[model samples]
Target: MALEWVVLSYAAGAEAVMLLLLTLPGLDGLRKGLVAVTKNTLKPLLSVVPFCLFLLMDIYWKYENRPSCGDEHACTPSEYIRHQKSVMKSQRNALLIAATLLLYWLLFSVTHLVIRQQQLSQRLEKLRNED
Candidate 1:
């Protein structure tokens, strides 16, 4: 039961990272370019929305299912241990996932930004030559 919360926490952290990556300027620029394509192609890209929504639902369900750490007035020794362990494990997993996502997002954003920058430079050069 405790482990479930740990996993859910990790998942939430991961989702947050995903949201950040999707919205950040570098990524957003690439997404905008892709969106300019035909609606048929955009349909496939839009699929990510439903998929993310489903993931959020699953995370919430798992989090809600975890048992409460008894009442504030009376808590057993075993319950205390379990709760502590769960919180620790959840934090560890969430940090790990966040780090991994950050690394991947950095690499992805840099690559896309570089490509876009090159394209812009070429366009600017062409305009200057035309003048």
Candidate 2:
């Protein structure tokens, strides 16, 4: 579980950095490279969709089987500790799943927009050439 969290954290950080880089000025080369790669091989990235669905299922299972801290005020010290840990773990898992989905959506939308823009540009160039 720790390893999974570490991997996810690194991936999320890398994605955030890439997004920031894409918006910076004087990075047209980097942007074009990303667009080109994405255009050529976007189908592979869609695999993440199923993976995210799995994560969502895991979250649902955890929620359905959550440990109840019956009578919060009356919980013994150990019972309270256990409940707190369980709640924290569940929250972390839910947040990670949400973040992963959001990242996938952002990447997919950006790739689609980039491809559309390229197509429109090509059409405009062809029209200009015919004139």
Q: Could you say which candidate leads in TM-score?
A: 2
Model 2 per-residue lDDT at 8: 61
Q: For candidate 2, lDDT tens digit of each residue in 1-131? A: 56755666665555555555555668776878877765454466556557657766776887788767666547778988987887788788778867866776676677777668778988999999999
lDDT of 2: 0.69
- Model 2 vs. true fold: TM: 0.74
RMSD of each: 8.8, 2.9
- Give the per-residue lDDT of model 1 (tens digit) for 1-131: 44644544554454445445444666545654542332233334344345444544554565677567766556688977886786665556445444544544554454456457667988999999999
Q: What is the alpha-carbon lDDT of model 1 when measured against the actual structure?
A: 0.53
Q: Pick the candidate with the highest lDDT.
A: 2
TM-score to native of every candidate shown: 0.39, 0.74
